[model samples]
Target: MSTVKQLIPHDQALLVTGSLNAMEDDRGHDDRSLIHPVQIVLDGDVINCSCFDSLGELGVSALVVVQKDPLVTYITTGADLIELSIENDGSAQVRRIEIPALKDVHEMSLLDGVLWLANTGYDEAVAIDLDEKCVVKRIVLGKFRGKIRASLPSFTGNDIQAVDRYHCNQVFQDINGKLCALVHHTSGKQLLKRIARKVIKSQGDGGVVDLDTGQAVSLSLKGPHSVRCVNGDYWVCDSGSRMLNVYDATWRLKNRLPTHGWGRGADFSKHHGLYYVGISAERKRYRDRPDYNDRNLIEVFKTDDGELLGEIPIVDGIEQINNVYLLQRGVVETLLGLKLSSWV
Candidate 1:
């Protein structure tokens, strides 16, 4: 039995898909290695294998995973894909596709056969075709607020302020289909003052920018990572400083929950009628490449009173996961382990 597990509500029980990976260098050898790319699915009552083969390294760096009908895509920093073909027997084969123009694609989404990706290194968003593995369109938010693509978040739960920092944050889509964007600006004096608080500064603009109209708006936060759409509202998680900021669908910061306990990725849990955030290590800093197998675990908390709920300890030395979308249905487990040609 796996000791590592996630916590679910009373109506929604916990399930272990065991869809995961092995730390390539389990022995703590001098040489850094990689285990075959792996993933898993944990349905309410069933846990099955995934249909993916190509462990495109991009998905790991971006910290992204999403399953669309008939397809599952992983986007890493290299802006690549670990494509798979789902078979009748629930097995999968991997297909490699490289995406250009993305310096570093962090997060991705699939809607209406279109793959929406955020370029973490660049201030842009790209949509691609899964079948053809080609670029369809691109949205370049030149100098949008500070690395607009660090970690794009997608919300399937209630509006509990999922994230607060630039990374692992989400973008919202309103009724008109226009994207909610951060309008940004900066003052050298103001920035220098904020530096005292250890604020993560953006290379793009100093403030938030509008997505469609490209307007500048005043936003407040210690740090804002990802944005998620929940029940016609938006949840913002600022993991850098451990705060959850709320926003209306119109892109206004409305409510805030201080780091009552811990939260990396937060969402409103319908089953419990409260907001929940998946908490993990704040972020690790290695002095001289510290040992990998020391301590790596994850936790959960309530967004309402900031109560500690559960803990998940993974063996892969993964310490930077903010949220996990646990649905009533199981995972998109069409893909299996890969038969790689050679990862480069």
Candidate 2:
């Protein structure tokens, strides 16, 4: 049996994004089905699950809590965006915005009121003006063949051909306040050509790039997913290597911690003085050994010493976790509006 430690404070909760698992048996079921993408709130032993019923058949990738007073959250589901607002009484309201240009959208970062989305399929980072609800800018990356436009007057999902050249998965604000993107496979276009010829297998060719200058900031990574700046240090989830890499302000690797599974989502909780890293079960194509049922878990580590504290299994029909965010429990409670029941 798995035991959970009471590391999280009572005042805070973790808002987690569980990506859709198409491998599950109940793929085409209704909204109540657990195989679809979901937003989960973890408060100590209690777990609150929320599924988007209005938005049908979309995979929830990443989300950001833009406001806390009314508990407003923006979630990325494939090419669509969901605006979720929670009232004081705990009722939830959802607004879906369709952006056809975005494909395989992943992590997002908010800077100066603009939301930067990693449009993975198109190998671009798209900037959306929240108030205006329009695509303000698009930063093309990694051997994209499509024509670059200075500005998009309207959302055209079909204007550009979708290709996952770089597999650009995450976009976040660096310590210097500049936007940076984590490309899962930096040389993805070359790798795709090699794959067509059946010559070589995909290897670790991932790196981080500064969106402003369109230059690589960090290199020699394997399937990098998320990046966060904590106390002047950059933490990256080197997923393909199943390692948590820490880099100094100069982008020098300071430490590397081995996570048993494929490391993906990551966040630091200042209130708890710890770091939470999400790991998913290794895919069959990448695994050298048999799969482990208990591989999908969250690894908690001490911030100061990088000590492995404990592991929290993500069960209850959640097959994979994409992102993790630590927020106030009061806010989540208000947003969920659910009575505390039993431990997960």
Superposed by TM-score, candidate 1 places the C-alpha of residue 304 at a distance from the truth, in angstroms, of 7.1
Each model's total of backbone clashes: 41, 2
Give per-residue CA lDDT, model 1, range 1-79, as digits (tens).
2223345543342212111122332333322232222323232222322222233331243333345454454544344
Best by TM-score: 2
* CA lDDT scores, all candidates in order: 0.43, 0.67
lDDT of 2 by residue, 1-344 (tens): 22354766666767666655544442333343554344444544646454342333444678788888788888876677778777777666767665667777778888888888989878888888888777888888853323221211122332232234667887778788877778755433324223343333344667776666666643567678888888889888887677898899888999998887878788888656789888876553344565443456788887777888888777654456777877776766665563323211
TM-score of 2: 0.81
**What stretches of model 2 exceed 4 Å from their correct place?**
1-5, 22-32, 39-43, 46-48, 51-58, 142-164, 188-201, 286-294, 338-344
Those runs of model 1 whose alpha carbons end farther than 4 Å from true positions after fitting are 1-6, 9-71, 74-78, 143-171, 182-208, 250-254, 260-276, 283-308, 327-329, 332-344
Query: Which window of 10 residues has the lowest lDDT sum in candidate 2?
Result: 146-155
Clashing residue pairs, backbone N/CA/C < 3 A, model 2: 100-157, 101-157
The candidate scoring highest on lDDT is 2
Superposition error at 118 for model 1 (Å): 0.7
TM-scores for candidates 1 onward, in order:
0.61, 0.81
